[model samples]
Each structure stands twice: as structure tokens, then as C-alpha cells.
Target: MKVVLAYSGGLDTTVLLTWLQEKYNAEVICYCSNVGQEEELDGLEEKALKHGAVKCYVDDVQDEFAAEYIYPMMQANAIYEGTYLLGTSIARPLIAKRMIDIANAEGAEAICHGATGKGNDQVRFELTAYALKPDIKVIAPWRMPEDFPFEGRMDMVKYLEERGVPTTVSAAKPYSMDRNMLHISFEGGILEDPWNEPDEDMWCMTKPLSQAADEAEYVEISFEKGIPVAVNGEKLGAAALLKKLNALGCEHAVGRIDIVENRFTGMKDRGVYETPGGTILQAAHRALESICMDREVMHLRDSFIPKYAELVYNGFWFAPEREMLQAAIVQSQETVTGDVRVKLYKGGVHVCGRKSPYSLYSPELVSFDEAGGYDQSDATGFIKLNALRLRVLATMKKES
Candidate 1:
């Protein structure tokens, strides 16, 4: 048997590599999609081979992740339950799609992932696998036997040690993390209790709130049809621009979220995510849309944002509704061209100013100063027309 595994150079996959090769007598081809984990992907191929992979493919996929996946969610103002921007949720499908592509090219029969059955990731990873290739076989070792989980990190480390595989993980830490270009997520370990406060040391992407600068940091972002084009007047491509924004936004302690959400698989899980660049981009995009988008178009798209976000979060990227909604969202971005100046202060990305060539904001009409298009007196008749139902209700109350 030959199996393709989505291998992160982490405790799970490091052990999973040897296990699959030995148990199924399988030829393992490990695949790692670089979505900006920022870790040393160096020697990952060597490690995979040492653990029994026939070959390992390390692909640079950060640009595709940002352009094809992240930007679409940004365009739609996709916020799941009004908080999460669906960062991790949105990236999973793209990664899985690539895994399938690699699987086909390698002529591998079965695909495997390290996602446990208890989490949303299992659903996200498996759904996309099946969606793309209906007959794709999934190897989920977490549900295999009573001795699985390797009894947590320590046991996994011991198992690897006993098997002569080297690992960097130690028993000292009390957390599990998933990192990518879009966001870094933390869960499990000490985070199981909702009341427990996260340790200050646990965060990697953002500074501590107290350490953030006292004074506000101003940033100007340029948008072309709803996509971020530049930062502070300097042009950058998708990934480069986002990474720059991430640095600046993280300095201000922006985009840290703690939410215990209902998973798509009918379970509740606590997910803490840090999405600094995404925060700035989402805010800036929305600000531009205010002026550049038509009122009716904005309203219609706004109505679908929640559903679109939910669909993405629930692992429905290939679903017809999600695809249909994405088409509409992209259509809405047609006129969202402009620039927005934002002030970042201690975890806040505030829209200080916004301008667009297509701005619907009419200063001349809205001005309360002498020359104006809006008549304050005109509101009286409008109010009277609007109050007819209230007047009828009042008359009925008096009569009764």
C-alpha cells in the first residue's frame, strides 16, 4: 500500500510517518504545504525519510493561500458569529485541495492527515478530501485503538524515542498549536477549561497588551477593487503586503480572539487565534466598501456575509451555496477601490479616514453649514408619513 500524508513537522505526523509505513507496509510520501508556519522546514525531507517516507514534497503555497483563499473571505467581510474571520477554517480547504493534487500526481491510493476525530479539523480535512476525490481513503490513527493518542505528547515522545526517531517536543509544555500565514491557533492542553486565563508566554504573533505602544500608530493602506495593494504608499504583492501588515498590527496588539465556539461536528471547542494582518485588512476593506459600494449592493452582500462566513467555517468551501456566495462577493468587490488610513492603538484598528474616487459620500449635500442639498425641514413630512402607523395605534388606544 502507498499512502500520502499531510505531514507537519510536529509530534503527530513525526510519529505517524513511521507508524503508517510499518503497520500497512505502506510506501509513505509526505507532503508539507508551506502556509507561513515560519518554522524551519529545513531538514523536514530528511526527517520524513528517516521516519520511513519514500519521498517528501515541500511546496511553497503561501501566495495561493493568501490570494485564492484569504482574499475571498476578506472581500465578503466574512466573520463567523461576528468575531472569527474564519482564518484557520478558510485555509484548510486550500491545503487539502493541494494534498489531493499531490496525491494524484504521486499516484498514491490513500491520503492521511493528523487531525483528530474530536475536532473540527477532522471534518474540514476529510470533507474537502471527499469533495475533490470521492473515493479518497482517509487514515485517521486517532480513532484506531485504545492505545492511540500515544497517551499525549510525552507518550508520543517516548514512543518516538523507543522507535529511534528524534523529536523536539518535551513534556514541559502544556499546549498544542497550529500556525499558518492567516493566523496562529492554540487549543487543548491547559485551555480545556473555559475559565483558565491563557499564559502570556503562549502567544507568538502579538505583543502583550501592556507592552503595546502608548501612542497610536497610523497606517495608510491602498485598495484596488477590495484587495490590499500597498501599505503606507509602498506597493507589495499579496503575501508580502500581508506579512508587513502582520508585523505592524502585531506591534499594536491587534487581532487576538478567545472564543468557545460550537464546532460543525456537533461539539463545543475553545479556539484562541491571533490574526493581526487579517484584522487590519478586514477593517480597511470594510471602510473602503462604505464609500465605494452602492448602498443596495452593500446591503445585499452584508446580508450574506454571516452565512458565507458560516459556510466557510463549517467546511463547505466546495458547496454550491458557498461557491454561489463567493461569486456574488467577488462581484461586490468590483467597485471597492480606494484608500483608508487606520490608527492602531493597543489592540484597536480604528478607521481614522477613508477616501475613494467612487465615494458616495456627498459632503455638499450633508453639510449643516449655509449651502446644502439636504433640507432639515423636509424630514418633518418624511417623519409624518413614517408615523401614520403609530398615529393609528395611538387613536385606537385612546378610543379603547
Candidate 2:
């Protein structure tokens, strides 16, 4: 049998690669998607080849990831459970899509992933695979604990030592981390206890609040049709722009979130995420929309944010309903073209100014000092008309 596996050069996947080869005697083809994991991708292909894979494919999909996946979700202002920016959630579908493509190209009979049975990733990876290729066979080794007998990280460590397969990760490592362009997420081990605050040393992306600069820095972000085009008047591509903002936000100790969230697999998971750039983008985009978007259209779009976020969080990026919501989201962003000035300070992003060519804000009509366009007497009739229902309800209560 032939199988294509999503290979990350981690202990779990290292063991999984060898196990899949030994158990099924399958020709394993390893794939590593480079979605801006930085140094994590270093020596990945070489490591996979050392672990008995016939061939290893490492593809750089960071630009596609940001422009196609991240940007669309940002347009919807999708926030899962009012907090999470869907950093890790948004990357899964792109990885799965590439995996399915490789499966077809290799004529592989099955596709495998290292997502544990208890986590949401298992559902996300499988859903995207099946949605793309309905008949495709998915091999989730974590679901079958009996066949893949490893009690914990130590067990895998012992197994690798027994086979003389070298691994860089030490068993003493305190946490499991997932990193990409959008964000870096830390979970498991020490983070399992919800009450425990993540140690400051564990943070890799942003600075500690105490270390942030005391002086506030202002940045102007320009968006065209809800997509960020420039930062501080410098035009950059999606990936480049995000990297630039990540640096700026990291210095300011922004976009650090620690929360215990309900996972799709019926468990509460605690995760700490650093999404410096994404945080800035979300704030800037919303500020731009305030000046550009119509009130009713903005509200309607806002109502779909939870549903849109749920789809992304649950790994339904390819689902029809998500696409339907995306259509409305895109339409809502048609007028979301503008620039927003933001003030960045210790762990905060403040929108100080915004301007758009399509702005509906009429300063003259809103000026209280001048009554620029209006008569004060007009408000009396308007107020009375709106108050009629309240007056009737109050009269009924008085009579009773």
C-alpha cells in the first residue's frame, strides 16, 4: 500500500512515520507544508527521508495561506468565541487541501495525519480531505490507540531510542507548540491546567508587557476592499506586511491571549496564542468599516461572524455554508476601503483616526453647536413618533 502523510518533524510524527511503514509495510510519502513556521521547517525533508520515507515533499505555501485563507477570514472579522483569532484553526484546511492534491498525484490509497483523537485537528484534517476527495481513505493513528501503543511522550522517546532514530525534542519539554505565519499557539503539558498561567519564558512571538516600550507608536494601515495593502504608507504583499506588523506588535507586547475554549471534540482546551499582526489587522479593518460600510449591512455581516468563525474553527472551510457566508462577507467589504491610524502601546491597539472616500459620516448634520443642516423643532416630532409605543405601554401599566 501507498500512503501520503502530513509530516512535521516532531516526535509524534517521527514515530508515526516509522510505525506506518512497519505496521502496514506501506511506502510512505512525507509532505511538509511551509506555512511560515520559520525554523520549524529547517531540515524537515532530510529528517523525513532518514525515517524511511520513499520521498519527502516540502512546499512553501505561505503567500497562498495569507492571501487565500487568512485574508478571507479577516474580511469577515471572524473571531471564535469572541477571543481566538483562529490562528491554528485557519491553517488546517490549506494543509489538508495540499495533502489531497499530493494523494491524487501519487496515486496513494490513503492519507494520514498525526492529529490526536482528543483534539479538534483530527476533525479538521479529515473533513477537508473527505470534502475534497469523498472516497479518500484517512488514516488517523491516534484514534486507534490499541494498534499504536504509546502511553505518552516518554513512550515515544523510548521507542525512538530503541530503533536508534534520532530526535531533537527532549522528553522534558514542557509544552507543545504550533506555529505559522498568522500566530503561534502553545498548548498541552503545563497548559493543560486552566488555572495555571503560562510562564513568561514560553512566549516566543511577542514581548512581555513589562518589557514593552513606554512610548506609544502610531501606525497607519491602508485597506482596499477589506484587505490590508500598506503599513505606514509602505506597500507590501500580504505575507510581508504581516511580518512587518508582527515585529511592530511584538515590540509593543500586543496580541497575547490565554483562554480556555470549548473544542469541537467535547472538551475544554487551554491555549495561549500570540497573534501580533492579526490583532492589529482586525482592529484596523473594523475601524475602516465604520467609515465605509452602511449601518444595516454592517450589522447583518456582524451577525454571521459567529457562524463563519465556527465553520473555520470546526474545519468546515470547504463546506458550502461557509462559502455562502463568505459570499455575503465579501459583498459587505465592497466599500471597506480606507486607512486607519492606530496607536500601539503596552498590550493595546487603539484606533485613533479613520478616513475613507466612501464615508457616510456627515459632519455638518451632526454638529450640535451649529445645527448645521437642521431645525431643533424637527427632533421633537421625530422623538414623539419613536416614543409612541413606549408611551402606550407606560399608560397601560399606569391604568393597571
Candidate 3:
């Protein structure tokens, strides 16, 4: 059988490449999606070829990922479980979609992934694949009931080492990491203990809070229809703009979070994430929305944040409901154009000032100098009308 594997050049995938040939006698075509993970891809093709891949395809989707996937999520302000930016969750669908495209192009009979059965990615990859192509076969070795050789990370490491394949992970430091343009996540291994704090050395993006820059730095971010368009008055493409902000965020040691979150698979998982650019973008986006979005409209859209985030986290990116939410989110952003100035200091991102051509904040009407309509007396009647229900409740209580 011929199959296409979603290859990451990681421990699991590298071991799986040879395992598929030996176990199922399958011809494996390796495909890696480049979403700005910052890994060295220079020798990836050669590495795959050396490991018995019939063909290896590396597609760069950074710009597309930033624009189509990341931007839309930012527009909705989607955050899973009130904290996670869904960095790993959000990137999976895009990767899975491209993997299907490769499967179709190569005329492969089955598609495989390195995601373990216990993780959320297994759901994300298979859901996207089944949604896109309902009849496509999926090969998940980790999910097999029996006859799978690898029992643990050590086994996989030994398998590769015995075969003369170089691996990045070792028994000395066994942890799981996933990265993309938006953020990097660290989990598993020593992080399994809820009370154990992550070592500072494990951090790949931001510095320690105490070691952050002493001086505060201000950045001006401009948005057009809720999408970040420029930084410091300099226009940049979607990927370039995010990269620029990531650099600035790194300098200030911004966007670091550690939390225990409920997974869709009925388990609590502890995750540590460093989302430098995403954190700044979220703050700036919300700041601009404060001035540009209508109060009622903003409140109504805000109500969708949790649901939208849950959908993304649960691997429903291609579902009709998510698309419906995206439609409403895009509509609400029609007038969300503005500029926001944010301060980065000691791992904190604070929006200090915001302005927009369509700002609803009427300074004159809110002034104490009796400017713009002189409506002080009107508030008394409005207040009394609003308080009528409370007065009746109080009267009933007093009589009782």
C-alpha cells in the first residue's frame, strides 16, 4: 500500500517512517508543512530520503497560515479555556488540510500522522481529513490495539538509534514540544506533575519575567478591519508583521503562561505556552475594538469568544458552525479600523492608548463642562425608569 505521512522530522515521525515499511510493507511519501516553526529544513529532504521515503515534499505555508488561519482566529479573539491562544490547536487543521492535498496529488491510498491516540491532535488531524475527504483511510499506529512495536519514547529512540538514524530527543530530557509561527508549547515528561514548575532553560521564545528588559518599550500597531496592517507606521505582509511583533515581544519577555486545562479526551493536561506576538496582537486588537466597535455589537460578539475558542480547540475548524461564527466575526470587524499604542514591560503587555476614525467615545458629550447636549437632568429620569423594577421588589420585601 502507498501512504502519505504528515512528517515533522520529529522522534515519533522519524521512527514511524521505517516502522510503516517494516510492518505494513507500505510505500511512504513524507510531507512536512512549513508554518514557520523556525526549524532548519535545509537537509530535511535528504533526511527523509535516507530514511526510505519514496518522495518528500516540504511546502511553506507561513504567509497563508498567518493570513487565513491565524488572522481569522485573532479577529474572533479566540482563546481556549480562557487562557490558551490555541497555537497548536489552530495550526493542526491547516496542516491536515495540506496533507490531504498531498494525498490527493500523489494518489496515495492512505494518510498517516504522528499524533498519539491520547492527544487532541489525533482528533484534529482525522477530523479535518474526514471532513475534507470522507472516504480517505487514516493510519494511526499509536491508536492500534495491538502489534505496534513502540511502547514509549525510549523505545522509539532506541529503534532509530539502532538503525543509525539521528534523533533530537533523548532519555536524559524527554519532553514534548510543538511550534509554529504564533507560539511554542511544552508539555509531557517532567511537566506531568502539576506542582513542578517548568525549568527556565526549556523556554524557547521569551526570557524569564525577572530577567526581562528593565525599561518599558512602546509600540504602535495599526489595524484595518480588525487585521493588524502595520507596525510603527511601517506596512508589512501578514507573516512579516507577525514576525516583527514576535521579535519585539521576545525582547520584552512577553507572553508566557502555564495552566492545567481540560482536554476534549476527558483528561486534564498541563501546558506551558509562549505566544509573544499573539499576546501583543490580542491586547492591541481589543484596545482598538474598545474605540471602534459599537457597545452592543461588541458585547454580542464577545459572547461568541468562548464558543469559538472551544470549537477551534476541539478540531471543528472545518465544521459548519465554526464557519457560521467566522461569518459573524468577519461582519463585526467591518468598522474595526484603528491604531493602538501598547507598552511592553517585564513580561506584561498593556494597551496604553487607542484611536480610530470611527471612535464612538464622544469626549464632548462625556465632559463635566456641560458641553455637547447638556443632558444632566435627562439622566435622573433615565435612572428612575431603570430603577422602577428594583423599587417594586424592595416595596414587596418591606411589606412582607
The candidate scoring highest on lDDT is 2
Model 1 segments more than 4 A misplaced:
146-149, 375-381
Full-model lDDT for every candidate: 0.88, 0.93, 0.91
How does model 3 score by TM-score? Answer: 0.96
Tens digits of per-residue lDDT, candidate 2, 1-400, equal 8999999888888998999998899999999998988866777788898889998999999889999999999999999999999999999999999999999999998999998889999999999999999999999988898898888888898998999998877546688898998999999888899889989888888999989989999999999999999999999998899999999999999999999999999999999999999999999999999878999999999999999999999999999999999998999999888899999999999999999999988798788778787899998999999999999999999999
Candidate 2 regions with alpha-carbon error over 4 angstroms: none
Give the C-alpha lDDT of model 2: 0.93
Model 1 pairs whose backbones collide = none
> Each model's TM-score?
0.94, 0.97, 0.96
Worst 10 residues of 2 by lDDT: 167-176
Clash pairs detected, candidate 3: none
lDDT of 1 by residue, 82-177 (tens): 888887898799888988998899888899888877888888888899999999898888878653547667788888899888888756557678
Comparison by lDDT, 1 against 2, better one: 2
lDDT of 3 by residue, 286-345 (tens): 999998899999999999999999999999999999999999999999999989999999
| Prediction 1 TM-score vs. true | 0.94
Root-mean-square deviation of candidate 1: 1.9
